[model samples]
Target: MNAEMQVILDQLEEENLGIRKKAIEALKKWEYQLELEDACLLLEKAAEIKPLCEDEWDNPSYALVTAACIFIHEDMVPVIEKNILRYSLRAAIKVLSFLLVLNTESAISLYKKTFHQFYDHGFACTGV
Candidate 1:
């Protein structure tokens, strides 16, 4: 990673929402030049960080994750899959959906494991 990009990555940890948004934008602008590892790191960080939700429907984390996922190669699927438990049922659905569009095989491979939690959560009323 370049010095400028490193600085932007550091900005993700800033307490100020505006600074974080700016940093995310900067990284997006530099997406073409981002390394796979750097992109994965950014995606991981974006997934871990809580979004600033001034507007109820708009989530910066979703946008950041989607954009960051663009630069992440298929080889990093394991790293991302391992973090599935960190996501909510709804979030895991969205991530799985996103992955489905990106790579059907990989998404299907993970769905059985990842969606089981969601299925179980919804089926708690039933004895199944």
Candidate 2:
């Protein structure tokens, strides 16, 4: 809703993945606070953007993970964790790595939860 948020949202909507990734990084670094409604709106808008084609260097998955890393409130961690599991292990690992860099406690908790879920389902990581 603020001018800064509007600009960031605009950048996220840009056709170039680089621009969107930059915007996501900036948003993460700035760590701006938003009202729940405003944050949800921005996240919804971000979700509308399509993922990049295979040839694109800047993957939208990075932005999505960055956004989740930056914007996840304490109450939203469970939801984000659920969403993370829907992604490939590589993608989930990348996102969890970022999350760990940003907030270790939450990241560890999510990792434990995800690991349990996977183990219960007979899923296992194939490589070290």
Candidate 3:
């Protein structure tokens, strides 16, 4: 992994949830500058850390999803798709919903990919 990805993964493993949450939030701000592979890797790591609270404020998934939105390329969509069902469905919906807000060509492709995944999983796009 690259230095940034290492930092992200390390943060995910931090004992302090505050530190991990801040790191994830910072990653979101830096997402556009990261390589697509690195961003996807970081998201994977973020997803592995279970949420400590149901509220978005305490959940790292919010940050992870926001970060993922920045690099929603066709190639990375599969990575997100593969892990969608592994994490909290509510969290996945929150992240994927943010992805839909991105209007870039890559974002549109990811939106379709994610939409299909949610639909296949029996989630209603309209409600989530």
Candidate 4:
């Protein structure tokens, strides 16, 4: 991961909406400029964040998830896990559905463990 990317990610927690926005944009730019593995690490870190607000537009976690979608997908799984409570239930579901499209196995497993009562019966984790 780029050291500069981590620096910008730190700004996401800034209370100033404008500062977070600029930081989000800068991180998004790195999606194009950085190598895929480094970018993935950057985005994964972003996903680990929990936004403080419900405003999707100003929520850096949401912005990071959306922006990182273009270059990173698998890393989003943990993001959904960690930040599920930070967002409203609706927004949380939306992000999960998006992850399902990107990586179905991880998303479904996460969904089952968290929400599906039958999940404990015998739904297995498969490579497919």
Q: What is the per-residue lDDT of model 1 for residues 1-128, given as tens digits with 9 covering 90 to 100? A: 66786777677667777787787677556645457776566556545755445543234345445555664467556756865555433345556676666665776687666667658766231100
Ranking by TM-score: 1, 3, 4, 2
TM-score per candidate, in order? Answer: 0.64, 0.49, 0.63, 0.52
- Candidate 2 lDDT over 1-128, as tens digits, reads 77887787788778777787777677656666676556545434433555454544344444544554455555545555546555544545665565555576777788777777777976543211
Root-mean-square deviation of Cα positions for candidate 1 versus the true structure, in angstroms: 5.7
- Position 126, candidate 3: lDDT: 20
| Candidate 3 lDDT over residue span 15-121, tens digit each | 78787777767765763546787768755754676765545655565566566656455566566656665545665775566556645566567667777876786
The lDDT of model 2 is 0.57
In model 3, which runs have C-alpha deviations exceeding 4 angstroms? 1-5, 53-55, 89-91, 98-128
Q: Model 4 segments beyond 4 Å from truth?
A: 27-56, 71-79, 87-91, 112-128
Task: State residue 110's C-alpha deviation in candidate 3, in Å.
Answer: 8.1
Best by lDDT: 3
Candidate 4 per-residue C-alpha lDDT over 1-128 given as tens digits, one digit per residue, 9 for 90 to 100: 56776677778877777787788677546445556565455445544555555555554554554545564366557765665544433344455667667667887787656555225533221100
User: Whose TM-score is greatest here?
Assistant: 1
Between candidates 1 and 2, the one scoring higher on TM-score is 1
Total residue pair clashes for candidate 2:
0
All candidates' lDDT scores? 0.58, 0.57, 0.63, 0.56
> Root-mean-square deviation of each candidate, in angstroms?
5.7, 5.8, 4.8, 7.5
